[model samples]
Target: MNTIDLQVPHVIWWKDPALRNLYLAMPVLMLAATINGYDGSLLNGLQTMDSWQNYFGNPSGSRLGLFTAIMNLGGFSALPFAPYIADFFGRRIGTALGIMIMILGIILQVAPGVTSNMFIGGRFLVGFGSNISIGAAPLLIMELAYPQHRGKLTTLYNTLWYVGSIIAAWTVYGTIKYSGSVAWRVPVALQALMPFIQLIGVFFLPESPRWLCSKGRYTEAMAILVKYHANGNPDSDFVLAEFAEIQETLRLERESAKLGWAIFLKTPGNRRRLLLIVLTSFFSQCSGNGLVSYYLHDILSSVGITNTTDQSLFNGGLQIWSWLVSICFSVCLVDRLGRKTLFLIAGVGMLVTFSIWTGCSAAYSQTGNTGAGSAVLAMIFLFYGVAGFAWPGLTVGYSSEILPYGIRAKGLSLCLGITALSGVLNQYVNPIGLAHLAWKFYFVYIVILVIEVLCIWFLFVETKGPTLEEIGRLFDGHETQYVESEEDKA
Candidate 1:
């Protein structure tokens, strides 16, 4: 019945050049999120661009829906193996491989004519690569980030999603001016640009020191730990303590069981963590985000706004708005507000938006009022701002943090794997529903978000101001690990 006052980080930002340099890798990983976001938003953005449709043979109704939803299938298929790739070969290798695969996908997508075979294949590869890059990047970021600033840094991955989404939206929006096949081809081709930079950039950055330690590359891990955490002072208490904790966590995992699926299931503390992870991830997608993310144009067209220009404008603006709001949310609120509080508060706002969208869409369905449909249309931005603040990067960030080092990669993979699979359902089913059920599809999410809010309120714990190793203690019967400094309490 007592209060939980989340404390601030112990680290000072401006004074620490070493921490700043370590945080540098974050933007690189962000590009991974951007690509993932762009891909998710791309088909819809391009779908709104007639030039794209014309070259791609203007897929409509079911075929168009399949193309959009198909990417999730790619993500789903890759999730199970992605963890293994990341864990076995290493996070950097996994990220590099994902980028390379995505590049191949980009090449195939720009082919002339409908090129349906290439289209599906290209999109599938993009999905596969994105899941790998997106999944691996966050783990690297979380592993490397100083514990005090980890939450804020890790959640920014989601904000980068909007960065990618906005770039795609504007790329398509701007390039919509081009005529014939060139219009769509140029934008689609442009997709290769940033990720290519990221593909090259990953090599310059340090590997996750924790991952290095787990593999018995202690010398390399110690070098990275001192460089980042201790500001080149190997003897610094913070660096020594953090390095020891990482070693301890790895030792515990090694003693308990060999790394595999069973470790996650067998441990009671880990079992609870895994359960919450699945539930959190399930809520992330099922909250009806896909309805807007993948099919905003479709939703708009339902209201009789058939013009490509208007659709592109609205979608572009929404991406920008979502990006800005999420960036602000991650930078300002994530650490300050803490994870659970924001999720709960923002869930209420999302609930309001969804309920209104359903009512408005339903009324437009029956009344055929342009105003009613427009009201539903405007709600998408409100929904973006609210949901962006609540779940976005924080959900996955929290999922990764709660896990023990033994199964951390696999656990994070499991969480995202479920989210990706759930997205497949959203992508596949929603198109069919939008085609047939129209506004009624909103009702399903309305019910879902209500449950999502309840779950957050009852289940989620405050995760701010704790080291990842310390957080592990909260779940396991292990002795209190990585306790925050007293200065952090102030």
Candidate 2:
């Protein structure tokens, strides 16, 4: 086989009942990303509700920023501890723990006549818990998926963000017909649904086999591989090859793994991995999508679309469009096109759309031209359509895939942490910028998007056609040495 060929083996997962069951259980983890998407769109939707604005004092400036930024702060607070839980307790337990905390947050959010303090507190817990689960989910999904299916399964993991967004957008749109607090409370209370589903679905999931191997439970690890990857046949060639590959890779990793945070900086390969992780996480949040994801109401009002119904309709429509675009690319193109290609496409596409968006916003501001305002609306959808290609698919999965087993959980935690911190800054600054500078604020993202494209071109490597364990060779070169046994050599 040519080394760069991206084609995966043609295994029909549904033909094998065990593999079928394994795939069915994936939603337990995928919903972690969904929770985050729902939270973002839910806030955007609530800001448009009259009763919500009246109840909350129509928070603007720093106060409104806090309403949006607190969640990321809460998620950041949990980052340092989340990986420890994931690494020590097991991925399944870590996920369940996060969901349980998030449910507590929903209870606080839905309490009758909830005070601002209590609501903020609830948002904090929800962010905190959601980050913990999000930190663990991609790692487990990649580790558990059959090698041929791993890329699609892992990439598709975050794409479900749009699924949650779609639900929140339309839910908010539907509830807008009511004229009371129920308009907002209904949407906020529904945040609990995904976590509840996750809590139940998680019980049915198998523990990550690589994690079991790391803990010296070799028998248990092999048993899972045998059952799911090879339909209960321990003697099957597929099962035997996979088991040997995992054992060999894990042995090499333990020998070279670094201690503490040194793992991110101990060597050149580790340094490259750290750079990619930080840049990827930062770009995912700061690349102008934050403006739309959390503050579509503000954007619409600035353009004279003050009617609540029109704003809700546009928000709902955008989510549906985003979901469709994300689903197509993640399932069909992520593997075939490779990581770097899709990322470059996203960067360049966002740059073009956002530049036009900025120009139209300026024209609308200066002349009050409804046509320019209309153009700005079209640009918003184009921007996200371009963004959906990579942000929803690659952000978490690409970062997770590049790290070796020793630091997978910890590295992912750092990725999410950086993402939260970047989000904090963007959420706080965006409203302030829009209030003061209006369209001028968009130029910042235009500049950042240019840098994003350059970085993707120069720094990002193609991580196609390798197993999770084997991909390290692209970074470490001769440092990640694997010996082929005679049975494998044949």
Candidate 3:
């Protein structure tokens, strides 16, 4: 089989004779994903604890819903500004700054005598801090990885998110049983450690080569790329070609408009790309995954698992299995199945599962029938394994690759901003649905799923195995025809 030449320039230099730096960098980046995931999901288990009520003064009905919703609200509030920060300061700086904010947020939550207002304020800070990682990580990973291995490497970040969720579930389950305000604070407070560690560790890593090149620091960017790609036969012409491509891409971007908000809105094709990306991100959140992850215990209670211990254990175990399944599937098929196909399949599967789930929930609520309700609940979780886990992991990877290099960070930030907003709405509405109309709540998810399917089928494009240049062409509407080539096979 013919190997597709990567076309990198020869002037780039690696740290050593081999490309070990690139391999080492993967773990560091993945660690960022893991911590981000863990903290994001940690709240899942803590919601049921007595400390939850203590911190929030026994919030009931609509108030309880608002309390839960406020977590996402914090995130949404900061998202619009995340892009500007990332663009103006650089991806690494934006990420570090966000983590620092998260450290403050966690401290407030853990301190003694924190009122509900304080708890909300603290969580809002956490949400704001957390968005930086989600917004920046995908772009960083994409710029760093080789085209052939990009999908698999980027999915590692998503897999770690599930790992974080599982950890949160188990940590809260174990700690909540011990009896004290610490039960909840301990789990919530632990999130502080992640950002602190990330902040310190990130300083040691190099800035993104793409971002570096964007800023006209071509020599430094080339050096970092060399370190990552050194294992490729240095004698081969592939390196020079790749470097030329990067240079050309950067030149085109700079000549176009310097990659600012003006460029984002002025370019017609870019505007469309931004819209699709935002829609996909919004649908991903509104699909009710957030609702399920945040309110699993309540959902179980509606189906008859009223015991707190049983609920915690069951919910925790489900998260574990979901994470495990997502990792397995992401590692195996993300490259093979491609982004568009997996999304369509997952969307349809979720629609079916949630539809059944909605009916089962309604039945259980009306007739007090646990048997059918239990079965539907099980299916809802199974759907999570198939749909929830796969979609998020792949969505970030796909979104990162689809936009042109010039607008990559801004486009990602815009998409993520929508994600943050939708997530806040989902979180806010989840408690309300659980409190007021338990069975009817999932109907919102079902509606979102339908919209997701329609949008994906109509607007989404297949981005598997394309070089950044080819992807840019697709985005520009200049390349409507796709020609299969040997490089695409990898």
In TM-score terms, which candidate is top? 2
Model 3's alpha-carbon lDDT is 0.70
Assess candidate 1 and give its lDDT.
0.78
Can you tell me which runs of candidate 1 are displaced by over 4 Å? 1-9, 112-114, 256-259, 477-490
Instruction: Compose the digit string of candidate 2's lDDT tens values, residues 1-490.
Output: 0122223346799887988999998977899999879988899999999899999999998888999989999899998899889878888999999999999998998898799999999999999999988877777888788888888898899999988888999899999989788999999999999889999988688898888887999899999988888789888777776666667667655654545676677678889999999999999999999999998999999899999889989999999999898888755799898988999989999999999999999999999999999999999999998887898789888998898776778889998899988989999999999889888999999999999999999999889777664687788874543222334446
Model 1, 321-372: lDDT tens digits are: 8878877875578878888888887788899998998888888879999899
* Tens-digit lDDT track of model 3 for 1-490: 1222354333322444444466565565565555545644565566677767665677765676566666566666776777667766777788888788878888887788888778878877877777776567566667766555667777666666676677777887788776678788888877766567667777677777777876888888777766566464544455556666677665555554453566656556666677778877787677877766677767777888777777778777777777777777766677788777778878888888888888888888899887877877688677887684456676567677777766676677766667767776777777877787777878878888898889888888877766666666676655321222234434
Candidate 3, residue 456: lDDT: 84
Lowest-lDDT window of 10 residues in candidate 2?
Answer: 1-10
Query: Each model's TM-score, in the order given?
Result: 0.91, 0.94, 0.88
* Backbone clash pairs in model 2 (N, Cα, C under 3 Å; residues 3+ apart or in different chains), count: 0
Score residue 275 of candidate 2 by CA lDDT. 98
